[model samples]
Target: WTEHADKKGRVFYWNPASRHSSWQHPLTPSHKALVAAYRRIMQEEDRLAAIQSELEAFQQQVEEEVKGWRQSHAPDGTPYFYKIGTQNTRWDNPRDELMAHMDLRMKMLQELSQMPSLLEEVAPPADVTGLDRTQDSAGLSEAAALTDGPGSPVAP
Candidate 1:
């Protein structure tokens, strides 16, 4: 293989006795430019592949976390749905509803957990005194009321 440079200072390789005649022939400025562009495209592809691998790793980590959470919080032994319209069993335990509530809480907590990192990326908010940062438990009470309300299977 012989290396050659075009008028534009672009480089190419000349391979003799190759099935591809283009490689054996002298490269023009356009051909050199195409080669450079191809090299750049290959470099970009490599960089993207690295980024894709990182993303896959991160995805696997998240999946594992979710699996572990499900195993710990939502065991298979626990029934997720309750049967209705049965005299032998008038009502089922509110475990499924409670699990849904727990799942929602987990998702909210995950979102809230990212707030510190997001805040770090931007300017800090102005400090204000006497402002309440704590969440009210009224919503929790409301949810409980709903669970024990009429039409609820758990309701006596």
Candidate 2:
């Protein structure tokens, strides 16, 4: 087999015995099917890589957010604890509000933990070339908008 390049710089492989160019050579059905499958595989692999990268970025963001929340709420690094006892052991002012906030934060972390499995369950679309695969600050902007708005849990 010999490889030849046309005037347009397109290269193709063909048998030396053939008089016609590689392009003029007839491709068998199986050869066409193999080429189509190869293209599909390449496209799918690219899509999967993009999705994996996005998922990793999202995972890192969740971890950082949870870490920041924990640091801000508990600078001492002590885990929140609740104790049930008689009136003598119970303080007059219970930290129910702080506990509620901590509960919400815990729930958020729990939801974040499920992200990896969710990512695994996601499949690449048939046509990934047209999809926006960029990882940008749009998600952060949306999150900030939600948190910095009026009646938000956190103060500006």
Candidate 3:
């Protein structure tokens, strides 16, 4: 990194590797780590913002899907909704179903968020000298142990 002053005499730090400038001083290795961390933070923030935007758009689409719907009751006091000028009728609120779907999607999103950590845990280490500890003599599974099948299974 190199330091310079702006026209107003305000000091800043520049990184030749990243070609980025910041007002904060990057004087040490820790500061460089901070810069990398800050970049990661910014990327995560942007990712969250995009997810939020998509969620908002999804909600808006749901609202539009149920626009002009009027709530009413059935003869047995069961609630329902009917469109303003159409033959469409629903026995349940559209939002209720959509919200339930969104809940499932959010759960999937949470699981997806942890996938990288799971992958990291299962990945091979850079140093392979100790990998033999997990290997068998043939480095393979027996026919009876191949998914507990007597023979290899064909691909679907």
Which has the greatest TM-score?
Answer: 3
| Tens digits of lDDT, candidate 3, 1-156 | 589999999999976644568897653433353345334433563544444454455457657866768889989998878878899777656556455555554454445444545223345655433222344588774332222233344443
Worst 10 residues of 2 by lDDT: 85-94
Report the lDDT tens digits of candidate 2 across residue range 6-56: 799887766533233455433343245334433443455354454444445
Output the worst ten-in-a-row residue range by lDDT, candidate 1.
82-91
In candidate 3, what residue range of length 10 has the lowest lDDT sum? 142-151
lDDT string for model 1 (71-109, tens) is: 112354643322343222212333432344344434433
Per-prediction tally of clashes: 0, 0, 0
Give residue 100's lDDT in candidate 2 (0 to 100). Answer: 38
For all predicted structures, in order, the TM-scores are: 0.20, 0.20, 0.36
TM-score of 3: 0.36
RMSD versus native structure for model 2: 32.6
Q: After superposition, how far is residue 148 of candidate 3 from its true place, in Å?
A: 35
Cα lDDT of model 2 overall? 0.41
